[model samples]
Structures are given as structure tokens and as C-alpha cells.
Target: MAGPYWFARNIRAGYVGRDRYGKGVMPIAWQGRAVIAGFVAAMIGGGATMFLLFFYAHQMALGVVIYVILVIGGAGTFIWAVATRSDPDKSLAVYLAERQRARSTGR
Candidate 1:
């Protein structure tokens, strides 16, 4: 899951998370609302794609269309979320600070 991978990488690099993640798990912050629908669409599209690859290979065109739509929708939602956020640059700043701190501590 590239979404989760990039998210975890950003978190580890201190690019996000103003609040701490409970239970040692942190989900992508799509403004806290679209996460559910996003999850469902991603899971269903991916699962259907895999299932089609095995049983009904001929139906792969349909699966590809559905999967593409899901990806586009997810990307659109992420863009929208960024547009609505007031302090998107804060995370970038935090990331830079973390990098500087790490460099200083290393030397």
C-alpha cells in the first residue's frame, strides 16, 4: 500500500502529526472525513483486481477501469484536503527542523 508507506515515511521523517498517534498507529489525515470512503474504495478496487486476475482474467478491463477511477478519486481527495488546510506548510517546517536536528546530533 503506497499510501500507507508514504504516510509512514513522512511520519518517521517528522513531516506530520501535530498530535501523537495512539496505540502506535497513525492513519493518513484526509481531513478526518474522507478516510472511511477512501479506505473502502481502495480495498474493494484492489481486491477485485486481484480476484479478477485469477478467476475471470478476461474481465481485467473492467477491473482496470475501476482501479484507475479509485486512484484518481483518492488523488483528487488528497488535493482537495491540501487546498482546505490552513497550515500545510507547518508540516514541511517540522520536517526541515527534524532534518537539521538529526544532522546536528550526528556531528
Candidate 2:
């Protein structure tokens, strides 16, 4: 048997775009925004749950473990989405270089 796949098949390139400074990606479409929203929701919900577990339930060790897992899993999922959905041909470095050249030439 094969392991479960986590990526969405309908995610297309360009949904995420490279940052202006070539550091990272940003959402360029609704799909990308949805991914970001999901990540945010996961973090917020997990934090609240962890708080309750630590204080109300009196499970400090378990709460810490759960919170760590949530952070790792959420970050991994976000990275996977961005990696698989971003435009492959777009390079922010190339764009910035071209812009610099144009400025130097006064064009």
C-alpha cells in the first residue's frame, strides 16, 4: 500500500508568487490566500486548545507536546503548498537585475 498524499491536485503554478526581494512567496490568487488563511486558523485554534489543555485540563507536558506538533505540522503544510503551487519560471532576482540595468541605462 502507498502512503497518503497531502497535496491538492487542482493547485496550479502562479497561485503563489515570489516576493519582490527574492526572499519568499506571497499569495497571488484565491487559492494561495486560502492556504494562508488555513495556516493562520490552525495556529490560532491550536494555541487556544493548547492553552486550555495546559491550564484547565492541567496537562502541561501534553500541551507542550501537542503545541510543538501543531507548529511543525502547520509549517510543513504551508511550505508544501507554497513549494508545489508557486510559479516555476518566475525569478525575483532576474526581475530585480533587469530593473537595475534599466535604471542604470536611464530607460
Candidate 3:
């Protein structure tokens, strides 16, 4: 079965090939993992928030507190996604150039 395409291809080629300085970190994979992790965390957080709202339904102040917490959590998730930006095409270009140079030098 064909899988989702990343960076216009799904080949198992390691761009940057794990440099010592870790500068070659592939942002595509990291971004995907971060999104998945964030979604899961959000789901759990929403559930917990709902539970708290239900538990404290008798108190109007508690409900308001829960609403604020949920709103803040949701905003935090959005901000986190924005903060963890990724540009895989540039990384792929670097990888290709390095490979070409290595092959040309017979390394």
C-alpha cells in the first residue's frame, strides 16, 4: 500500500544522515510527530476538562475556571504548532548536494 508522501516522496532516504552536530534534523518527521502528540494531548486535556466541569457543575465559579483552563490549553496547542515550524524542502536540497559531492569525490 502506498503511504502518505512526505517532501514530495516517501523514500527511506535519510537526509543529512545524522550529523554529529544534529544540524541535519529532518523537520518533516518531527513536525508530524509533534502534531500527533499535540492532538493526543489535546484530546486528553479536553476530556479532563470536561470531567472537571461535570464534577464541579454545582459551582458557577468552577465552571468558569474550567472554561478558562480549556481555552488556554487550546490556545497553547495552536501556538505550539506555530512555534514548531518545519521546512523539509531545504533540508532535502542539502542532502542531495552532499550526496552528489560525496559521489563525485568517490568518498
Candidate 4:
């Protein structure tokens, strides 16, 4: 099926490829990179806000709640994006084997 796919199983040349340990995927494309960047930014922003709220504003409870929400939400979204955007049918081992076969066949 054709799609607005942001990830692929072509590990050697995909934008997002399966991790070597068979646990996750890593960004190899600009789109995937942008997702990572956004996550990092969100985390940093949340941390700064939490720090300010806890120390300066004297709102420790609020700060903790907000920080927890941000962490859960951000992590959930990131995981969802990676899972939904990646090629689901193939694993790292499969891709590696395919690459090996292609190389051997000189194709």
C-alpha cells in the first residue's frame, strides 16, 4: 500500500530503521530527526518550567504534576509515533538478510 510513510524497513537506507538490538527504531531521516528534536525540546521546556514552578513560584505540587504529565504525554506520543510510522512487517534481522542477499546477487 502506498502511504505518507515516514519510516521503512530498508535499514541501510531508510529514514527510520529498526534498532540493532531488535527493541526499537532509530532516526535516519530528516522527518524522524525532527520528531526526536521536538521530543527533546518538549522535555527541556518541561524541566525548566518545573524547576521554576517548584523553586521560584513555591508551587512544588503543581510543578510535580505538570512535570509528570509532560513526561507521560511526551513519552507516549513519541512511542506511538515511532511504532506507527515504522515498517511493522519486518525486523532488523530480516532487513539485514535482505541486504546480504541483494549484495550477493549483485542486484
Error of 1 at 84 (Å): 1.9
| Regions of candidate 1 where Cα sits further than 4 Å from its true position | 1-30, 33-44, 86-107
Per-residue lDDT of candidate 4, residues 7-92 (tens digit): 45444444444443343575534676677777787788788889999889999888888878877777887777787887666544
Q: Residues 1-107, candidate 3: write the lDDT tens digits.
A: 00231222222444444332233233244455565466567667766766776776655566667666766676576455534443333444555666588789998
Q: Evaluate all candidate structures by whole-model CA lDDT and list the values in order.
A: 0.50, 0.63, 0.51, 0.67
Q: Whose TM-score is higher: candidate 1's or candidate 2's?
A: 2
* Positional deviation of residue 86's Cα in model 3 after best superposition, in angstroms: 2.5
RMSD of each: 11.8, 11.8, 12.0, 7.6
| Residue-level lDDT tens digits of model 2 in 32-100 | 677777788778877888899988999988887877787788788789877776665534344456658
Instruction: State residue 90's C-alpha deviation in candidate 2, in Å.
Output: 3.4
Q: Which 10 successive residues of model 4 have the least lDDT summed? A: 1-10
Best by TM-score: 4
TM-score of 4: 0.61
lDDT of 4 at 84: 80
Q: How does model 3 score by TM-score?
A: 0.35
TM-score of each model, in listed order: 0.41, 0.60, 0.35, 0.61
Off by over 4 Å in 4: 1-3, 8-21, 89-107
